[model samples]
Structures are given as C-alpha cells and as structure tokens.
Target: MNGKRGMHYVGWKTLCKTKASGGLNFHSAVSRSGPLKARLSWRFLQNKDSLLYQVISAKYGNNLWDATNRRGSSIVSKILLEGAQ
Candidate 1:
C-alpha cells in the first residue's frame, strides 16, 4: 500500500442536513448569517449603551436607520441596514 486511505468527500447539501438524516447537521454561511445579522441589527436598535451600537452610531451618524443614504457603508453596515428593514 502507498499509505493512501480511501475516503469520500461529503457534498455541501449532505453536510447541511440534520444528523437524523445522516448528515453532519451543518449550516451554510447564508443560512446561518441572515438571522444572526438581523439579531445584531435588533440589538443595535434596542441597546444604545453597547459599544457596538455606539461605534456604529458614531461612524454612520445617529440616524443610521435612514435608508436613503447608504452611499459608502461597509459590507457589515449594509448587512445591518438590510437586516433592520
């Protein structure tokens, strides 16, 4: 033997299924992030004293919720803005 072990790579769809369905029960990036981003946006709205909220407010202005002017926001900020809506 050349010391090579036989193994098969799992497909993404298989990996993303529930363990009961014979998969690893993993979540894809988009599946995991949408709700999490929305949750973060909600936290920003509800918790003004948090450091994240303070920083976002300062950088994006106090009216970060304004949808009309997202001219130069970062990807994260854009995600937060979309999640808020």
Candidate 2:
C-alpha cells in the first residue's frame, strides 16, 4: 500500500513476496495508479479537461477524472458510453 492520494487508504495489489503481488507498474498500471500526491496535485484540473488531453485524447484527462472519480467507477462503468460522461 502506498500513500499517494490516500492510495494506502484506497487500496493496492500486493507484490514481491512469497505471494504474487498486484502492484502497479508504470507500463501496465492504470492512470489511477498515480500517487496521492500526484492525484491531489492534478485534482484541481479534474472538472475542466486540459487543452492537451482534449487535443491528444489523454485517457486521464479532466472529463474522465470528473465523471469517473466524481461519481465513482461503478456509476461511470454502468453508463456504458463510448465517451465518458
């Protein structure tokens, strides 16, 4: 568990032990794997999509952050839209 935005509090997969870990690796881990500090740092931008993300289609861009994080994934996932709400 890490303490990035409260990752230690939220949850993380176990890793590097007698048991296999589900720890996030930069190459494959989801953008949500950002540390709490990163999350908090980038959080202010959540509601408004950044020009770059909007232009390039960043997956963690503002709209996704707001719709996904603001309402929680279950609601977002259930929405079933090609674009996030």
Per-model TM values vs. the true structure? 0.72, 0.18
Candidate 2 lDDT at 55 equals 38
lDDT of 2 by residue, 1-85 (tens): 4545653442343332223344543232553434533553344236346553353235434444344344444432223222322
The collision pairs in model 1 are none
Deviation (Å) of 41 in candidate 2: 6.9
- Model 2 score (lDDT): 0.38
Error of 1 at 31 (Å): 1.5
Among the numbered candidates, top TM-score falls to 1
lDDT of model 2 at position 59: 43
lDDT of each: 0.80, 0.38
**Candidate 2 Cα errors over 4 Å, as ranges:** 1-15, 18-53, 56-85
Q: How does candidate 2 fare on TM-score?
A: 0.18
Candidate 1 residue-wise lDDT, 1-85, digit = tens: 5658777788999999999999998889987787888898898789999998778778878667673476777776787887877
